[model samples]
Target: MNRSSSSRAGLALIGVTSLVLAATGAPASAAPALTMTLSSTTGPGGGATIVGSVTANSVTPVPFPAGTNPTVQFQYVGTTAASSACSASAKVVSPIVVSNLLTTAGTLTVNPAAVKRISTTKIVFQVPSSPYPVNDANGNPSTVNPNGLVLMGGQTSSRWSVCVYDSDNVTTSTLLATATYTLAIKPTITSILPASSPAGGGQTITVNGTGFAATSVATTATAGGVALTNVKVAANGNSFTATTGPRAAGDGLPVVVNAPGGTVSSLDPDNNSQTNDPPIPFSYTNGISITPNQAAAGTQVTIDVIGAGFSSLTFDAGAAPIGSGAHVFLVKDAYVANSNRGVAECTGVSVIRDTELICTLDLAADQLNPANSATMPGVAIAEGAYVLTVVADGGTGAGGSANPTIVSSGATFTVGPY
Candidate 1:
């Protein structure tokens, strides 16, 4: 039975082999043949260049072999010292572009190797793939790196290589040309906003400037002798908004704006279009007083008062003790005080017409303390060497003066005991 099975298997093999030989009209042991060559290469910037050529040799063109994609690539491997092969490996910096071929010559492929730095004058590049048959107008395959192919900052150099490939899965690349070139870096800033505001603050305050990047802006201000609140900066680093308590009625309560760059002061330009030029300064005048200077304690003493330097002709006593319900005086004193302070009441005691009293007053206060008390009862009797101390209310009887207190001896007053 085993001998019979072996004879049957031999007959089947003979029949299959006869069919294969009849179909191809040739022996099954015949080997298929293929060939490929390298073409050309080019660089993007102005650095180095490579040229490749490829050709494929095969009996049949119909059903060509498999992979065939030709490309050219460039890389910067830096300079080299004398004897040794350039220290570094070549990096493919540009994308591969397929070369358009005119004729189908078998199959071919090209692959670029590392750049070879020979010296300042000469450099070598390797075409690791097969060679092809293709020529440029100059009878040589020309290679070029486009002018604006920027790898890092500016542009690529003219020195580079191009790769060529055929349909037979073969490749070849070569150094085509060389060029000299360069690269550059770009500029930038970091913040701007108000640094401060007033406590009893008003709207219409503006805070904006330029040159801000990653940092934050800060705003600050003093309100009613206290620090302001709700200081905020916008996310874009462009502007800032803040609300502060009412301002104390004096100069130098600054609304400071700060960033990493520097600090700037802000002012209310809404009321009268005032320019906040630094060191030039701005002011609000607290009115001054004199006359009927002697008033009995607890009596409603009405002294004439006059004011200047006010845009609206109104005074805001920031921290002054004088209340809103007090009466105003009608008198102007231009003979004393500078324009900024503009002659308000002074601190300490003084004499007036036939009276002596204690005078320690701050005109910036909102209301007088002790109610209607301006003098001590029965404190002194003097025919001479008596001084008068008068306080000004923003009312009819309050007299306005540049400087309220008379500094000269002729302005002295004496008071007799009640």
Candidate 2:
């Protein structure tokens, strides 16, 4: 008798689970039996008035008694979910877009004028193009709004499911159909100046575009899988400047740009309408630096020169006195003559990736010129700061001979008495 009772208990539990799984006003075990069609998939500002139709597939009939209309509403959550947001909320929040930012914790607020029942299987919707009162959704008093993540925070897009409910939202309401909408505004790029730069980065590039955030930290840009640093947008929100990071020389690499976004809409599809989706033909040369810069002159010790695009810098025989028209020099801070520089001791070269170089450079006695060693005379070596420079002919994008193939970045190396 006990065994029979246990079997009966298990069947009872299964029936209870089924009823909960098919709860009304919420998602059910059935797949979305609805499809939403909009005039366009993208638009500017949550302020846009989207005219769309929600059609049911295998779902229940939305009862539209000649004078009655079922509710057609939007349920939104961060399209990009985060674990922290589930437990903690923001301490401070910004003002949000009024039209489309709805919350789940309070009374569902939707203007009756926004929806119209055309048939049994479909309902037409016209989202409010004008602003709604902020207090309407928060019960006219509460400050907490779940949709704030997209409207007031940094999230670019919130997943919105256009839900169709038969009659009022209650335990018995039949959920007909729901679909997620994809809306975006493409940021236009007018141009990217200085068309080309070294793959090893450190190049300051100016990107001109419209609809920028001006001073917001959300504005960012990248090229060739390398991030842009110190990104600052113009006060007018039309242009910005940033420094590039290291990247290997390649034929094609994606150029990405981002701006302050996430209000009733997406940050963007991240497509630049002007430059034809990533302006092409970027030129790269070579850039490198050295480590442990404080070394005495005439020191034959192994010196480390590290930076990116070093593979573009080569010697016929990675050997001492790399004389393949490739030269590394430690030019005096007050350089006046050729001898005012030290022919860096690059006795050996190591290769792995383009970002670093474990090579040897001879720190010969650095000299300084009063006028010219041939004119007034010069000092054998000066103990001061010197800038490291390289001459890599035929580098990655080494443009011309008059300018050499590589334009290395300036790295300071201090020199002392031998």
Candidate 3:
């Protein structure tokens, strides 16, 4: 009799469970019979608008009534299960609890609303940042799980889902479907090359970093708070380029890159690494060109160098119009072959205009003539193919050794046998 009673109790329990499920209009078994998908898996911190649609396969799901459209209720939770909540199995509930964090109405307008079903519902809604939880399925508010972790403080991701309601209203609603997605991560910038350019802008700069999207529509590069132009991203997505916008001289503002995920500034550590993005070193000049293409050895020749950014320096414009303590050099082609053996370091650089400089090359003999030593007589030039490099030092004294900030570009010239 005892064994029979036990068997009967087991049957009774199963029947009760089935009746409870039937009354709620929910399936007795949890299966992915209803498929749900979100338009995108990632978005910004404020939130992202996600469009979702559901399709039913084997399940003969519940149909929404004619007067009532299906509803999509969103929930921000710690768990990934479509049918379960974070607070369900825990012996102690977390500090965070949310229900119905956000909601959207199904809009498939068929002649008869009654014919509309969960599988046919389509809805759009936004998912917000974390630390703030959303309402649970029961339409109750959720709070942070004190015993768990805090996610909203950084570029972190949390599980978000939308549940399809059999009825247009959330109250007394039956969950027919749910779709899960991961929150988007913020982008980071590591470096910007050609760090500084003329204040006039228009320089093509290269930005290197991680988490950059594939198109300009998804990314923006800026200098001194001004937006750049012709922005292009690399195939690897690790770098991008943009033409700088005009700005005043001085240490121009930080370079910045903005994306849907997040904004990274030159002020931020490189890709969140320990290093910082190098500052933009703006100036009044940029290029160099030497006049009188060629000269023979032993000839006293004066060459004119033209370039911009030679004038209107930001600070330390001591004595020279180009700025105080600035030094310019006409290094010889030999310097390229070997710095130590070259006599290319031409001295006595003279500034003729903010944008121009004059250098005298003493092709006379091999060494400085004591009578003209003060002019720092130029080094002897050999016959053959050679190029001269123009180096500008924005510092005090020769070579501007005091302050090493230097801007240089070249002009190639040849010397014939004298």
Candidate 4:
């Protein structure tokens, strides 16, 4: 071959190499970058409508042509795994699964049709109230492509990411751009209805709050030290109802509520002050009744009063069991006389078990009487229809001090004149 002919051939080879280099872009060129912005970062877990946009930093480097449409997807990822059969790892997270969200018939990928494109850089999307990932063709959790990364409601501080792909074939396509996001909402309790309940408890209470879960197993409510039962959350996941357990009469009994998204308590570390509005208040049952409604004055009479919220002091088995420091009185009007107060009918206030209080109504005509004067003076009264009342703590006669600890409504009775 002549030297001139060889040189021409080499120039032809160089021209062909230049053409190939021009067609396949250089490797150093940067991949397209994406910026994602959300309308809001926090909302109740049941379902929140999230509006956002993914803007490409450089349109030239995008995988698709300028006018070509691209696909986008949203996922709640606990932690990333190489395959769908995921195991626990710091970088990988278990999907937040609501009941029936990922059943045998479903898949984990959100609906591609739900993504609405307004322009090249803008799009709008709505997350369903629950049952996320509009489609999971095979509810089987074992595979890695779609359902494996789904997150359910009630999980707090979950991490979410928006992945842009060339097409809806997420199984085979590589992600063009991914933007990580956070769904941060703690469980909170705004109010509890029927704040005050009977001392015996067992009252249905309504709890209003944000991020309440319909799944009762994922939520909890308690009053005092007793656990609440029959808990049911509203469909919107904003409120719930539960029956309270037995609690003694008192003020400032803490109420605690815990949900999958967050936890709130009357005795929270942020604010420990307790009020009836937040905590559980137990009022006296006020259903006292006497064995005999009528009795003769100045005669020894034993009365049985049955009601609730009567204090019973626990004593050592060997030690003398002191009666509950309760005082009974016979007055013209329970409401009016209760304000004035009176001495107890008998000093020995014996509590039979926890419900019944037995006391000797020693209605002696005169104070000079010494019968049954073991501890207190026999009750001296005139014949008339009177109301019987029991007061805990120290009792005073006629303009006496009120016992702030415990008080009961009066029982109607007739004292026959002798």
Candidate 5:
């Protein structure tokens, strides 16, 4: 008979069998035994949704035994290739029973309560919340935190045989899926050579720092309210050298070093920590100079000093010379008096030639006055005679003083139309 015809005939037989089984005591031998099948499983933590069907050949409505609690136990058998057995055993994830098989000729619907369906045929069977530690196919403990499904047994059996369902049928559980991650750390800056120098275009500064890779480092300089450019890192990746481009003279440009990764923590020359915990600070040496012993009134003179440590250099006129030294004045124009009106100016400066300080000056108004320019320009006779001061306002030097040896007694220069 055709499928439809067969189904109709089966229903008729089911009715007759039901009546007979209800009346007669001869346990209806014609009734077929119900069977279950598992379709699919899913979700994290080894949770699985199983799809199964209850089938019997007889037309009698096979009422699945009551109190029949069917449970799915998952054993974490070692990988198939593993020589030893899985240390962790399996436990019942989800327990269910065949509720009601309405018909024997058609598909039997298993209610949601009977089997939690994850998808069409895919059902998610609840697994233990605790992770199962098992060995992988390679004999290694599954490093995948909570290893998932392990297919054991049930190879030939219709993906749903009770014979295959039991633990006896299972040989070893095969790992199915796992979870996927990266590691990171911090960076630092160490030391900068030539800690002090004159500011302006042409100063080659070296910045040192660890963990510097490729173009991961940079340096910047700001002096006299101006920002310099062309910051670059060395090829070695440990140092960064660059020249100050067009900055005002006597400007103590604060050089900032930025490196890949993070902040640096190393002992500097002064034993100070370059880490800059309390104060993120760095040090650099520059090569520049300030000069001149004596000058006539209204003379535009350029002070030339040479040395390193010019990175963060500040200049002040009211600042005192070396020792109980004389007071230095920063003149504006060639007409200013010896008045304490010492205007602090940072201009016409360049880091020309190595680390040399190049600055231009316009004589003060009353510079020729007896109390001013009239008196001989106090000669800086010794090497340490001239010093670079880096104070907020007439403050002390940041990198101390550089004493240069004075070779000449005194040189004369005209400042005005005498």
Candidate 6:
């Protein structure tokens, strides 16, 4: 080959190399140049921190707002979207823009702006409410909670990961690992309805709060040490209703709830100054009783029963072992015939929560007769002083037993003819 031809070929080769270098584009750049350090990362329910410094990606370097750090962005995103386009409105955090080079550690603050919900997964900083109104989805704008990170309604996505990005940008490509902390939202109880109930503990109660889940198997509601029954959490993950179990008389008993977000106690930790009771307390009544314990053998006598712990009975639901109303009876010991120890049943007995009811004792003379009673079977109901006992009949079921009959003071009554 001639020297001139070889020179032309070398020039051609150099031209091809230049084009290839331009096409490759800075060696494919590099992953986000930021490291995140966080505390609450794995589980739900609890505050956490995010901190780190931002450096330019090896290839195309984007400056960090010139000299000021301004603010960092936080977002909840599905694992798949971590490196994909995340919306501006998805900023569930409000971290401060402390430094440009250091990017300092940030503490989480709870925004007291009424916890308005724009969506289930994010907090929107808008006009008059937050200092930075640049985070709505309409247009990619500026900082959120420009001063510090403000946490609101605990709606941290259960399936999404909490992520941090440099500056006010939540862009997928700009996802800088500023910190590795979890903002998974701890559960909180705000209020309880019908705060007081009878010591016997059979009342329906409503609990209002955030970070609760209806579908979570771990959710529970408890008062004192007894577990509340029939707990139903609302679909919104904000509240639940349950029936209280019987508890001894007390003031300000704590009602603890455990849910997917974590555990929360009704006892107000900040208000422990109340020496007598908890701020969010449940009180139990001292006792339960009935009035007008005596009645005639053939006539109806009205009786009044009163006390706390009276829960609305759901007979068909089998919610409790006892049924509605009170049953009256006299033990076999009250029978004139010693051998006839069967209990004397009352007729027309009605019962309810602290309600009024009339009872009748209509035992036939033959049934009550104690003489020659060994040969024939009959309940003994005779003229004598006796105590009337009360029982409830919710009936028994598989692997369950009926409730026990109760005897209390003011239950003494004499059976006499009118």
lDDT of 2 by residue, 253-286 (tens): 4456765432211112235333324344344555
**Ten consecutive residues with minimal summed lDDT in candidate 1?**
180-189
**After aligning candidate 5 to the native by TM-score, how far in Å is the CA of 190 from where it should be?**
4.9
Give the whole-model CA lDDT for all candidates, comma-separated. 0.30, 0.49, 0.49, 0.52, 0.33, 0.47
- List candidate 4 segments past 4 Å from native: 1-185, 216-218, 229-232, 244-248, 267-325, 331-348, 353-356, 360-388, 395-404, 410-418
RMSD after CA superposition, every candidate: 24.1, 15.1, 15.9, 15.8, 20.9, 15.2
Candidate 3 residue-wise lDDT, 277-327, digit = tens: 554333323334678757887777788766544454333323221223344
Prediction 4 TM-score vs. true: 0.42
TM-score for each prediction?
0.21, 0.41, 0.37, 0.42, 0.29, 0.36
Better of 1 and 2 by lDDT: 2
TM-score of 6: 0.36
True-structure Cα RMSD, model 3 = 15.9
Lowest-scoring 10 consecutive residues by lDDT in candidate 2?
83-92
Q: What are the per-residue Cα lDDT tens digits for candidate 6 across 300-357?
A: 4555545433333222222121223334445333322223222354545443543333
lDDT of 4: 0.52
Candidate 3 lDDT at 405 equals 27
Top lDDT prediction, candidate number:
4
Query: What lDDT tens digits, residue by residue, belong to model 4 across residues 1-418?
Result: 8999999999999999999999996865435445556675333332445565665554434344455444544455433222122111112212344554321112233345555656666555554333333334566433333323323443434545555555555344445545544434455666778765555456798877666654423678787666889988888777889886544456666677766544567555222345444443433243456788778876777888665556563321211112234456554554232343432254356778555667776666343211221223444566777667655543234343344223344467777864
Q: After superposition, how far is residue 198 of candidate 1 from its true place, in Å?
A: 9.3
Report the lDDT tens digits of candidate 1 across residue range 33-105. 2222222222222222332222223433322233323233323222121111211222222322322321111
Error of 5 at 158 (Å): 49
Ten-residue stretch with the least lDDT total in model 4 = 84-93
